[model samples]
Target: MTGDVWAVGDAYEVYVGRWSRRVAPLFVGWLGVGAGRRWLDAGCGTGALTSAILAAGPADVVGVDPSRGFLRSALDTARVAGDAAALPLRDGVFDAVVSGLALNFVPDPARAVAEFARVAAPGAVVAAYVWDYAGGMQMMRHFWDVAADPEHDESRRFPICQEGPLREAWAAAGLTEVATRSIEIPTVFASFDDYWTPFLGGQGAAPAYLATLSDDRRRRIREDLRARLPAGEGGEIALTARAWAVRGHKTAG
Candidate 1:
């Protein structure tokens, strides 16, 4: 198994952070939590969702992630080095507990969702979003389709990214009013180089796999992607990314 590498914050920003930022506001807005509520951004890689929560006038927001390197790039907010499955925070302390684009990467997503519930106050919203890798996340779907390796495909590796699994996880964690939706955003690359260069950064699944390939094989894959991706006359490649977002409320005590 080719493990995903996420140490380089700059590389991750280019690869997926930009798109995750686009999804953050939408996910936050969907929650519709009122101003002045405390928020906990579990698995808050580089603070994409944490920044969005801040923009919503929260009383306070704390971001927790295992990546210290990524934390350095996060916005000025309360941050802690922690894992999603086992957050280093007091229980029932937050009005909103959220994770974005990070749930699928967790080794045990059910445990993480339980932690989300544990940290959330009664009636608090516990929500998360993950890239729809199997179908709607075109950026990754294109890569895996061209890469032509089912073993390396994230869709196969992370079945919990889908709607059914997400809702089930939330419900099993004892959350109520569990619901799921798709958040789609435009991913327009300035050119083929813009799209291809990020894959060479080796920050995520596809790039990690690419790093294991021989130079000649890498060139072949790059050329294949260049030929396959739809480019306009202006040399812009427009694609879309979709994330399945799940939201639920901790039962009021």
Candidate 2:
């Protein structure tokens, strides 16, 4: 991958999650930033929520991710490492399991969810947040706006964040009492330069774009983004990011 996956993950460590920040309003809200005593954070990226979980009062957290680079950043905050699909932990050993915007990225998110449920004790709460790609993920829509342009084939190169197939797969994984809802968090950027600089870093789909662009094409993209963003009354547009929250309980054996 032209994108340094680790660098990309690390870049996000400083930047907040547009979608993952909205974990508070969904029905699974109990599993808030600190809902578990001993929590397992599956697909925990850069450790934002994992760090939040620890502060929320968990004794110890095991944050897992597939990226060694992302995990490197995660280590700065918590005990984060490894894969979510096949966690290196024991069964029914966790009081709560939380995943943040990670389900869509994994190859088998369902199996990963099942793994999360398995490690959680019976009656333990399993919670996660996924972006609503088809409906409400605004930042994603902004990304697609550029990627979908005829001047670029960026969509094909970047991964799709479609929500339907993922949710169905989650259901197939035997996560019962599954309930979902949308939560919105406002993203505020200080200026166009602040927003545009991250794109130049080329760490994510946005960065993938910079790698492919001719100088003119790159400038056009940058300009297009700048033109689209309205100046905030308070120097920031209160952009709303949407994510779907899902929760299920492990059945008592």
Candidate 3:
């Protein structure tokens, strides 16, 4: 989250790529969580997932994130946004809670979990998903393959993307009946440009490296990435990607 090349709002749409889209639909289906009375989506980013929850049948689906720029874009996209740790909503205000591909990015995932538990009605469900980076996240593997040097390995910062540790995180948050699943989703790119161009713009991880690349070196990097992919006769790279999802129901008394 440091560095000048980073841009998250609309400037960073691809930051949430086909993978997020591919994963969102699954999070909704596996959640099997009805619309309920109300739903809260924490770390909702630009609110795509929030909108999906609403469409699934919830009378209300509120999206909360800490970034104003992101929220502004989220509102433009027709979803409400607020803080993740201190949601602006009232107490016991939701029937079920959800989050898609968000927890791993949070600095204090535990506090965020406590906040979801606090806002949900007793017996309501709180469910969320994170990319299993160590075990199944593939796009990062692309970057890591190209970027792993003696001084840096960006993937290491993401410990929660692994399943067992993520489950422990839920337990530590006091959520019970915790269950986890490994869901596979496809991440397909149209072309080499479609795959590698997004990175040169310096959006997320790619940008970090892009900023360090000189013009000739950047072009060389692009060529290198292209060579790794299958040639254009309907070339497809199957992202053996996954979403490590976990859910727990609040105790009913």
Write the residue-wise lDDT of candidate 2 on 167-198 in tens digits.
56556766666666567766666777766676
Q: Give the range where candidate 1 is weakest over 10 consecutive residues by summed lDDT.
A: 50-59
- lDDT (tens digit, per residue) of candidate 1 on 8-50: 8899999999999999999999999999999999989888898
Global local distance difference test of model 3: 0.69
Question: Clashing residue pairs in candidate 1, if any?
Answer: none
- What global local distance difference test value does model 1 have? 0.93
Model 1, position 3, has a per-residue lDDT of 90
Which regions in candidate 3 have their CA more than 4 angstroms from the true location? 1-8, 75-82, 150-154
Residue 41, candidate 3: C-alpha displacement in angstroms: 0.8
TM-score of 2: 0.80
In model 2, which runs have C-alpha deviations exceeding 4 angstroms? 1-4, 8-10, 14-29, 32-36, 75-80, 149-167, 233-235
Distance from true position, residue 196, model 1, in Å?
Answer: 0.4
Candidate-wise lDDT, in order: 0.93, 0.63, 0.69
Model 2, residue 181: C-alpha shift (Å):
1.5
C-alpha RMSD by candidate, in order: 0.8, 3.7, 2.8
